[model samples]
Target chain A: MTGTEADHARHNARMLRIQQARAKMQARRTLERGLLIVHTGNGKGKSSSAFGMAIRSIGWGMKVGIVQYVKGSWETGEKNFFHAYPDLLTFEVMGEGFTWDTQDRARDIAAARAAWERSKELILDPDYDFIILDELNIVLRDDTLPIGEIVDFLKDRPLSKHICITGRNAKPALTELADLITEFGEVKHPFKAGFKAQKGVEY
Target chain B: MTGTEADHARHNARMLRIQQARAKMQARRTLERGLLIVHTGNGKGKSSSAFGMAIRSIGWGMKVGIVQYVKGSWETGEKNFFHAYPDLLTFEVMGEGFTWDTQDRARDIAAARAAWERSKELILDPDYDFIILDELNIVLRDDTLPIGEIVDFLKDRPLSKHICITGRNAKPALTELADLITEFGEVKHPFKAGFKAQKGVEY
Candidate 1:
């Protein structure tokens, strides 16, 4: 079976049009600035995406600083694997645990404040090229730290540094400042099918 | 200004409900089979997600085999950084380049077939725990290889092997067999603003 002559002609025409659109779009894009990116949604890869970006940064010999909020001191595959890049990646896991695990509003707030303190220093420091605020949105959602305050701090951040904020339920105000936003929508998760979140894979 | 008591109560109630739903979901999931995962859509970071998983798998001391279907031999940061894991990670850049660059259908088909041959060997060999097929969807889009060949190959694969296929417009047959599928919806891309794709980040 084969496409008719008309069908083939139409396909070529469609391809040509798409090429033109892409070229037009590409020509207009020339700015190169550090991006404020947000990864949010109910999907499993939000924080994973952030870590992935961190790896990419490290691969390029860029210095990376990471502050983990809400994950606490648990052992994670990313933290362990990225240990290989000590000079390029500085990782700090500061949260006590998830909000549910802590169950204390005051403690959670304090931990967030401490993590944000670290985050502020990382953002301000000139040595780091990329900073990842892992799970900051979760803390923001719990109101442990005011979104406005964080946004205000980011306003004057260095122009060469890229920042990635990952978690679910990001506030609208944060979204406004993000140059790139990706919502990882879940199609099917094996956990719902009774697949335990195994070490290395889920972490 | 502090929230009223009603606001606090509403927040706690919402938190409680979320906790309950999470607990219920956690309880229902008990299966532990290896997954066929697909990362597809117009968004960025699909390949980065796969690389992140590769890092996780490496942390667990698992062997990884990677095949780049359409990304020809440009010096990639991943290739350089992951080179440190020579014993555990095997990275191959097999493509002749993007189809537009090659502009030869037969040449594209041959390059894709060679890559798939490598992919088949990787997936079938017991040495590899995880195999990543980067940009396979693009080759599939151009009919470089038939979808049925891939689906049939995956059918009899090891029960404990995890395979990740990344690219836009994944074939429906592959999606059908995939245990987890994520559509990375692009909210913002720097290229639209005229920023070119950078080495580490875009690769």
Candidate 2:
């Protein structure tokens, strides 16, 4: 319970003012174009968040191209879902394995290069409205491809195409150039308790 | 180009080791109870991630119940998709608007209480395998209802039902109680550049 009728009336008046201001701000935002989005940090849901975006893009009746650079070998639930929608989505598992699994540095680099080449082909396709470079930052972090070179290549990407990159330690250059970047920070996780990641939850 | 045939063989051996460890870890994690998930912080995608979970849960042939606590006024893209699945999903918009729009603190509290009551009903229903308390953290952040009370009530929730609470600034008590907690940190945002959050992206 707040206060009297006068307090309620005052609050209502303030809300009106705020709504009007928001309307003005909303109207001023007229430009609509593709966005470079990055999801990075030391928490869970980085890849899942990108997969969420991929799902929403399909919800909008748009085609999505996904290049899984660091998580290539595993069978994921999201991948299975995408497989059901062959017409709207193309999911390519390009990485040899996780960094720990693919311990050889040179092999990892080669896989990253191949994945980037596939990304380039996907980005060039006018049919795709959304292209997800899943865990691409791990490749960049390994120096398989220079972050600057990727940024330079994406400079002239289609105006209406949105590209999302997800991983830990996204390059500063990419973050600066991105229209939106979200970092998933760890608050608490089951892994700390030695609870291994299960199929549906982890994948 | 990476390395020779010998290098490839060595890499494959490492991959096998990693896979065996992962498999052992996976086998040890046998707890399959429904998750109490919290998605919070200043960055975007908290709600969308939960919506993504709802989608995935549906993919598993489970019904989902959604209560939009603070974001009831706006027409969201996800809501539109859920509308098409009347038989499977029950999306109830139980708030007047965002707290800013509904500036009366008393009214906001009342709305939150009403929504919580609805949530209780959904949580009790065995038919719903997944219940998303979308933006419930924002309602709790305002101290309308005690966060501890909510967590206490959820402690003995259904064994097979998963509940996801999403919003910014989730209370420490709730986070501690949650099985999984993901905090979205802002690295970059379009709003800072005066670009409006568009449909499909923001909604």
Candidate 3:
């Protein structure tokens, strides 16, 4: 082969190598995956969103665990609905209604602590696909649980395990550490419009 | 009046009223507010399960809107992220990504048109609190828009609308109706391994 032809071939090989490298980089960019999420803010559907996710996960034939803090009474539709799918998911509500309704700080703390213990299993368990800590922010905000301890537990969880912490007023520390953070801000509310909370709608 | 006697009389009156209401015999179920939802099951964040409803709606301070049509796709890290907000209430994802991916066409069709055009206003107008069309089954499978008339107009709208749809088979009907419908299914997913999608973690 001529020297010029050989040089051309070398250049072509180098171009191919660069193209291959670019393709690999693109593939890597698209291959990203994992889980760490926080749903925070003064919106209404935080628990509902988490529940929907839990249900979807259950449908996928994945084991799901839920720890609902500060919402134990008043017969939630979700609790009833999920209960029907016993084989697919496991859920626990660790609350005694609203804090004002319960009016027992020590009892509330104990309930939250117990729920947290169960939540730890779901957060750390490799067998479980999702762990929902419902209304945990309320627990933290009310000083029912130690925020630092909760953060530490979450930070130390298995890399593959997914955790969902739902509630209003998510601490800045949690937000900063979260892989994904969402803040729900209120725009219009039925309560503000004189509409009473309706069953099968709000609760 | 004696305290005991007064209490007894009040209780008796309440009981009589209850009996009379029972005899009249009509269960009064609270009606769900009529809402128009647009769920296009064809996008990456589709089953992040409509963060628009779970987070943005809350930011808007509106009532909850939820419509889930599929199963799975719950583990994408958005579920936990959005559910943290309080104002953004209610989210429902059909959970299924695509019929071809799940190999269940019947389920997909059933889920797609479950409540067609019910979410039209939310898709078309900017007044809704939160409108989520979780995984719209029809659009993705047929590639036909879910609603011919509504979608075309939405494309050119300027309303501050909060809408989200998820699924792998976004049809023309959906594209027409959607202010935003994301399509997310596996181009080459990493879960084919012994790695089954985890519950709560993935969903």
Candidate 4:
């Protein structure tokens, strides 16, 4: 071949390879199944983070199951509002109020255990896409439930189930077992500075 | 109790009520936590959303961590290009190649799960304010690991932890548990008919 023709041939080959590479990359995609997430720390908004993920997942036409672990009875704007979503499934662990308000550890543990049971179904079922275990870490940390059993159960859950757990005092074992973990640190909190949490914002 | 003062008192009470109600509606604020979020979707700009959140969070002097999940093998122009923010924790998943190119599920899963494990430490550490689990859905759906367990773990995490899980097929359970959910439907995609994903824009 002529010098110019050979040069053109090499350039064309390189271009072809680049195009192929791009096509392959574009075609690569992963399917939707399950996840395990932990949101913990001193900063605020752990529930919000879990809830945010829940809402996004539902928007994709995925079935969602939520178990609010601790703050159950008191009216929450999110509970009132998010329950309206047809795709979202929700359960509150407590019956009337917080532990301090009710002053009953037995009641709290019973409620949390009940909620955890319900969550187990969702976690083990491949049919459900996402599961939110809100305030579960608090329960675990407070000795309301056995952490080892919980971790073991979670470790063996269905491959298709995606779970999100939110609360404070995330245990080291839990963190070690988690595929994804998040810790929130408080730098400047409105509440610590005497700013009461607003209704829709903080609640 | 006076008649003249009573009228003014009623008006003042009404104003207070209005202000309180408005404040309640806007009370919700994003959480601060050492959490990681992965934004991956076929639609577009998953990373852009993450970057936007990162910039906003960093502006508040909150430590931020980011690991670009996928698209690392090739030398993209956007590497180490965060406007000279040395404090931002950044890394690339470094696919070594695209998922299809590797064509090895075990290898892909290993790489993804490994990256996820590394991210787990950062997410659990309180030193960082925000951790972005970008494109994590892809890994979950790929059957790299058990997504259900992952979700369950997250739901019961620390109280202060804040997490963001972004990607298409966000899963129903995730949506149900999230505080805020946004779905970007494809009203019009440039690639639908026949257009290539633009550099810097799509990547």
Candidate 5:
């Protein structure tokens, strides 16, 4: 065979070896169950990634429950769009405001307790397939809620229920219970570059 | 004042100081313009987060365009969902398959070129409010497309158009030109724990 033909033969042999190895690796991945996903760190896309997962779940006719623990009850673009799917999605925005806005630790703890009560119900409900605890980490970080209690409950959740938690400073207890964790780091931000948060993009 | 009253008074004064500082900071953020956003690294949600941004943009009655450069022409949950909004979104999946599946360098380069041409058209179109170039970073990393040429074109894009690119191992030149960059790191993945990818959640 010519040099080009020899090179083609070697490439084909290498590819076959890779394909076989991948198939063997895939065969070992047969376990299927609900996952505890955590998205945390000081960057964008933590909540947005959860929102995207919500869209994917709804696309497959799955029921999704979202309980926003820290976001104020503002008119967000996501909330407006998600409202169109009333039958599939139940979105409950129950926050008095940020910690500074409320300036009352007692009130903040009360709000977190109320939100957790709602989240607990959704997590236990059989109708819901996915539950998004948006920014629940902030509540844990501020010590508004007991981390041990929350972690214990999450650990004992139903086997077929998928739960996603999004926010910065995820507690070590929570991360240890998670099946998947993605830490988003900021390399650059427009806000630090003198740009105000724009509608639809930053919301 | 009583002891409790004095404590409340101090809290109120501290809250007032924080509110004033935030107000002063918010005053300096007056600039507004489009953003060149990049999502990269070795974790999930790079594409999913971009899809979430598409939803946010569409929620505000903005037109969106998407070009999937590396994902094969399979039925994805996001693709099916976005198809419902034909008038508002233009979804294009241009890749034949991943490089391993295709196994042809010339063919891969051709596919990347085709996808880039479509992306260029969307970026230049004034009617589009947001554009997503999904997995274009993989194309740049593989040398399927020249990084310098892509960077130069993006540098000259309209100041009022928002563009988002998502994939792993994003080129340094691209990130340097980006207004916002997020690096997603994997702490733990379910796949490593012997869990197969689930429908609606991993798609």
Candidate 6:
């Protein structure tokens, strides 16, 4: 309703140029290796995005492993849904709870260590194609886990195993080694509007 | 290994204070309503994260609806996975293709309008609890669809129906009206490192 024939033709020509440039870019991008994807920042959807990737992997019949570092005590919707895919997905909940809930540094450190051990096993395992270290960044941010060892181990993981680490305030070292880093910045939240977290959405 | 008994006691006392404050804050957040979530910016996982929320909603036995505006032509893993839940989901693919691939302004607008019509139906449908409008922002950014009418319709949607709109460059008007807005910013990407999109991970 808004474009003239001349305008349409001009738009078509501009799109043709873009299509050709995209083709050139696609031709140059030939490398295919597993990526270290990091999702961090003070926003929602860090772990949700990882879980979504897990579903996508399961759609293609690829094995997925997940380790929760700081959100294990509560029964979440994602957990219940992922439990349906035992053959294709292995989900390990290893956190005691949120740091505020736990309130014990020693116990938090112990839980982080155990979760990291499990994560390392998943990374080294040949059967899994995708592994999600859900909220691992929280542990790293609090210095509950050793970053150097974790980075070294991740760097040496299987060439075709995609690993996703998620949480707010990801360590700079980890982001430096990541192939993809998506910082989920929160522009607004319901909590600020005097609303509590709802079921099937916030969890 | 990191703290003495006195230090541990001090930490526990500090945490108690924080917990008390948290409880007081929680007491104030009592409102409950559906959320209008927007995922936007130039990064990966905007749509993937919305898909994840759909899975989370499904876990809680909630019905879902999805409309793919610009991604309907491709056989995405998400589309394939979501198709498994025919009983609980209404999946609509109503795009000719990407704008470049279509290169027809009139056709793109028609497809966008058609998709928006379907989206409105889903939003107003009482049976559906969650609805995802995938890549709708692209068409909005291109002015293929009328934003004012769409925004008005969305603002008047059911109070208990959660809606997620995902894509890059989301309209400022939508963000201003949204309950939650997560901007997914890309710090690094595999594509920049000469890596082509993978099967399960990318699609």
DockQ-based class of model 6:
medium
Give me the candidate number with maximum DockQ: 6
How much does candidate 4 score in TM-score?
A: 0.45
Q: All models: lDDT?
A: 0.81, 0.80, 0.55, 0.58, 0.87, 0.87
Per-prediction DockQ, in order? 0.44, 0.43, 0.07, 0.03, 0.60, 0.76
Off by over 4 Å in 1: A1-27, B1-24
Please provide, for model 2 over B1-203, each residue's C-alpha lDDT reduced to its tens digit, 9 standing for 90 to 100.
34665766676677678878977776767666677889999998887777767766666667889998887457666776678678768999996687567777678878889999999999999899889998998878877778878988998788677788999989888887898899999878887777777655776
Q: What are the per-residue Cα lDDT tens digits for candidate 2 across A1-203?
A: 44666776776688788888887887877667888889898887777777677766776777889999877457666665677779989989988777667667677878888988999999998999889998899888867678888999888788678898989999888887889999999878877665555444565
Pairs of colliding residues, candidate 5: none
How far off is residue A104 in model 1, in Å? Answer: 1.1
Model 4 C-alpha lDDT per residue in residues B1-203, reported as the tens digit of each score: 77845754655566466656655654653333333233323434344445545544544555667654565454432343342456654544534344555555456667777777777776777776666676666666655557786778677765454566666666555555554444433323434434344322233
The TM-scores of chain A alone, one per candidate, are 0.89, 0.90, 0.81, 0.79, 0.92, 0.95
Off by over 4 Å in 2: A1-10, A102-107, B1-30, B86-88, B103-110, B146-148
For TM-score, candidate 3 versus 5, the one ahead is 5
Worst 10 residues of 2 chain B by lDDT: B1-10
DockQ: the better of candidates 3 and 5:
5
Per-residue lDDT of A80-197 in model 4, one digit per residue for the tens? 5455665445545443244444445556567777777877877776667778888889888877778998999988888565677777798887877665555554433444333444
lDDT of 3: 0.55
lDDT of 1 by residue, A1-203 (tens): 35554654555566566667766876777777678888887776777677777777787888999999978436777777878878999999888677665555666778899999999999989999889999999889878899999999888788788899988899999988888888887887777667878654576
Q: List, residue by residue over A91-182, the lDDT tens digit for candidate 3.
A: 78777666554545556668888998888877767787777888888888877799999888777777765677878888876766666555
lDDT of 3 by residue, B3-77 (tens): 855754565566466656643442333223432223332112234444423432343345555565555434444
- Ten residues in sequence with the least summed lDDT for candidate 4 chain B: B32-41
> What TM-score would chain B of candidate 6 score versus the native chain B?
0.94
- What stretches of model 3 exceed 4 Å from their correct place? A1-26, A30-34, B1-203
Q: Report the C-alpha lDDT of model 6 over B8-73, residue by residue, as the tens digit.
A: 677767877888898899889998888999999998989889888888888899999999999634
lDDT for each residue of candidate 1 in B128-198, tens digit (9 for 90 to 100): 88899999988887678999898998988887788889899998988888888888888877776667666
Name the docking class for model 2: acceptable
Report how far off residue A198 is in candidate 5 (Å).
1.3
